[model samples]
Target: MATSNSRSCLKYLLHLAHDNLDFRLPEITALLALRGKPFHPCENFREKAPFWCLNDLSEEDVHSIMTRSICAKSAFELWGHGQTHSELKASLLNYPPENMSPFTHKDSTYRINVYTFNKTLEFADRIKRIDALEYLSFEGTVSLKSPQHIFCLLEDYGTDPNNIPEQPNYIYFGRWIADGQRELIRSHSVKNRHFIGNTSMDAGLSFIMANHAKVKENDIVFDPFVGTGSLLVACSHFGAYVCGTDIDYNTIHGKGRSSRKNQTWRGPDENIRANLRQYGTEKMYLDVMVSDASKPVWREAALFDAIITDPPYGIRESTRRTGSNKDITRPPEESHIPVSQAYHLSDIFADLLNFSAHHLVMGGRLVYWLPIYRPEYCDEMVPHHPCLRLISNCEQTLSSHTSRRLITMEKIRGPEEVDRLAHLADLRFSPYQGHNAFREKYFSGLNKREGEDV
Candidate 1:
């Protein structure tokens, strides 16, 4: 008979979806750190400390990875990680433990994005595993289930199999990464309200919020520049209450702001409304207000457990005005008239850091994305603050229209602790550092004695 301790030694199967090859090094590192394991980018999975069976887009490759994996999980909507399409196709073809008999103790967990389900279900059905499919979490559209349709599929159409397990022991709603959660937050509309100049949140914000959701619950989440309340919407969806503030009144009313005519233009703009209607919540109350993110008027709400926002990088209307009437620059076409001086891009970061320090609760995570104007500025800006400590520089990315630097910091006190953290941040931002070392150190601590099982 197998020993109780030995039986509990789980074989975790990890289905690594492809992330953009550009800026996901930090994101990859953060996942390993959170799991308290070391991650190696190469193909040898059998002997690794975490024993992750990673494969990209191909079903054949996924079958191969699962055949070798003991306990498996799936992650979806991975974009641009593989170098070629052939490589991606090879990855997915490797799933469902290829040609093996389904066993009673077969471990199962599935993670997917909302949009990928139509494709994912086809793959999930192929896995002939005999035991429970315990965990189910998604980052895609939650409204797709259409309860009636799901009932029909399960009961009448006989879609879901009889042998499959009933309910998951633990389930999470949102993306596998924090950045996915942030995007959902950014896309949200405040009671069907639109925004004047609010655009989408960078990819990393979505990753960070998803990670934060695992640890924080029943906490008030704050997004000062709520703009249509994307971040607030994500937090609310994840079972957390949210409070948001934006200066654009039109954003709170769903009416297009006069300055930002493109947001509410009735022509192509019908897409946003259509998508919301798809979720059956185009008229949902967002609980957001028209207030500046720099200065929030939070009411009876408790201190925020976390703060995640994409502060304008001077690419939007925020850049149009600065201190006085001096003109900064005009579009080449508008040489006839000059506009107000745009704010120095550097000042925006300075203000964002200061504003976050005031609102975020101690020990609460603050994940924000910034366009890198000057890398050296991060150095000068970091150590000056006493209340905030730059925890991790989750690498950098060239996001749409801007090269972004993702900085994850925590609110804390004590000058000495913050000082030490500054040195750590410096190492993290340095090329070829932080990620591997952090994972190595953490995994070693978790696995101090060899042969002593987890």
Candidate 2:
């Protein structure tokens, strides 16, 4: 029997998808962190590469990672790797014979797959490559349709379409383990979803945010600025109890203009809860309310395990919060609700950070997007709080001069009075404080070109 000791110190090969390169590391790291494992990449680790060899992980750990990773395509148990096929053979030979016996045993049925990155091999050539591996004695019966065990020979042709190399830059051989949850992206696509908004989060990105927050089974997840509960849908799929609040009554009630091209209006059944029900995650649905994020109504306690949101940046949706020029001490009556004025970009972030600090459990994460005018943005401009420690800031460029950063932060300490008031008193947020400041900056270049035409 293959024992835990036999799996110890064995390296794992991650076959990551080429897209969403920026979000890959943090997603994998956060998933591993949930399992109490630190990321230990093997030698010559390239963060941008399609393949990553990881050490200090067991087969179970790899399985756990594959369950949650959207940025990854598949995973394998790395038996050998080298700069060349000859070197790969030497490495495979050096591998302990005892480790090879279990898979190559006479009773087993197996098959080999040849996967090449950045290049494709002809069928005959692929057959020739597999035939070259005859040096490794295999006593198992060949089974192509359904195999008990599978091995793979992976070739890394340097990632350049223009300059195709005659030889592969690297080669890896491994035992197939598990595939990642790439199917989730297609299954949970917003195009197929029951409810969607103009700025509903993309299904892939929603799952990435949930992974970044380390959302797990039975965990409570919240989205303060929820729009059709896209992030909540992703969180609920991972077995988390999901709820959210939106200031837009139409959105909260799912009774608004349809974002679909041909659809005139949403049906009565159209709602966030219905979205969960469509995905068979209705049990994970808590509730969504029409409430202001700035003036949070939740009790003063850590009630959520993760807070994931995508605040409106005044492009697809307008940013507004309840208030008026007139100063009224008491609450407004039911007859006349307060008018919503422009909520500043700076204050939106300030309120979000403060709210997260107060509401998220210790070590729980706050994942959200921060819009940036690319030229004016610096690391210092990322909002900070004493209670929340900034984790990762990844960019998804929108235009030549504008991009939004996905920022992940973990709550380290409970809020202090000093921490709650920091953003209000800080001088750093002055640049984008104006309600239309970011909006104006985002459109300046476009307007300039239009004026040039005029």
Candidate 3:
């Protein structure tokens, strides 16, 4: 009986996927932020819990979220919930009959399903659970194959799989509204991709980064250290115009050795634009250039709407830039390539923060990965700039002692706000004071796992 405009009082239950626990809240929060809405979680809020109850959201809002969310599996209209079956019956009975009337009408066809988290149930047990919901008046006829209205009985047996409780810690009854975009993970997998490399990002995380960047239709996105254009492929899927720059000419031009096994050389079409074309978003491909990220080739202007990338941390790809020890007074010949030098992880982040602050439009975002030496990673080590505000920091652990944090920041003030003595001019470039400091720390963690002396 709730009108579309009056549905804010209705609560929605989100069934989030079990993986990527750290990224879920930020992804949902960012998606909600896209609609000019704040994340309003309800009682029994646990960061790692599979089910989350959110308040003050309309059904339309839920659909919009599910359309873009890779973290969530499905969403429901929370009709009633309780800690026990008897309590759940009481809660369901207490729900206004007017709200139930529309879906439970005699002329409507409906089906009831039972879902349990952290536990598997026999078919009989699932059927028994569904039959228990007979306490609620259902005037509709049962239609298992195709139902006009679908309802669910969800039970939470707690998160401990090794110690699942005999009874669910909680119970919920709701109308199934929509499912999330989780299929994108498998469909856009790197294994099936046309263009790939030694370090192409996984599909699910690419979508998550695009979601965190809050990329939308017509938005212009840029990647500073794009490898195989995985991030650009993700951004273009969201209708954003995508471009990038990488120091490696072979990578940018899709030449040289192929990343795929048994293939000695890359195909002529194995390029970033082709990757976007593989996903049917080729029209959104702007272009990628073989330019150094440290020395940005763009004119002095705020052109990008969102900048999303994953810089090399020396695990698979070496981080180098166009540079030299001795300064040359004259420019080299047009075809001559400059000698390369080490691009320290510390300076990488420093340059990234500064570049993002000046290049991103106001309210635009800069989403990138910062490798962490887990033991030494304090929040202070996240580089800062006057014009950018840290938004969300989520971790994706690679090893026992090594991980990378996905840091999302937004342009709060214009580039003009950056002033000498007010911002980072006096601050340390990063906690990684020297090139060896970062490189050694990163490799030492890996060495520790291999039983080698650091």
Most accurate candidate by TM-score: 2
- Candidate 1 segments exceeding 4 Å error: 1-9, 21-198, 202-208, 212-215, 257-286, 296-302, 320-343, 373-384, 399-402, 414-454
For candidate 3, write residues 8-93 as lDDT tens digits.
34789999999999999999999999988899999769989999999978888899999999999999988899999988999888
How do the residues 60-86 of candidate 1 rate in per-residue lDDT, one tens digit apiece? 333332222112234321221222323
Q: Judged by lDDT against the true structure, how good is candidate 2?
A: 0.90
Q: Sorted on lDDT, highest at the top, how do the candidates line up?
A: 2, 3, 1
**Model 3: residues >4 Å from true position, as ranges?**
1-3, 6-8, 329-336, 417-436, 452-454
Winner on TM-score between 2 and 3 is: 2
What's model 3's overall lDDT?
A: 0.88
Give the poorly placed runs of model 2, Cα more than 4 Å off. Answer: 327-337, 424-427, 431-436, 448-454
- The best candidate in terms of lDDT: 2
Residue 317 error for model 3, in Å?
A: 1.3
Q: 2 or 3, which is superior by lDDT?
A: 2
Q: What is candidate 2's TM-score against the reference?
A: 0.96
Report the C-alpha lDDT of model 2 over 349-387, residue by residue, as the tens digit.
999999999999999999999998888888878887878
Better of 1 and 3 by TM-score: 3
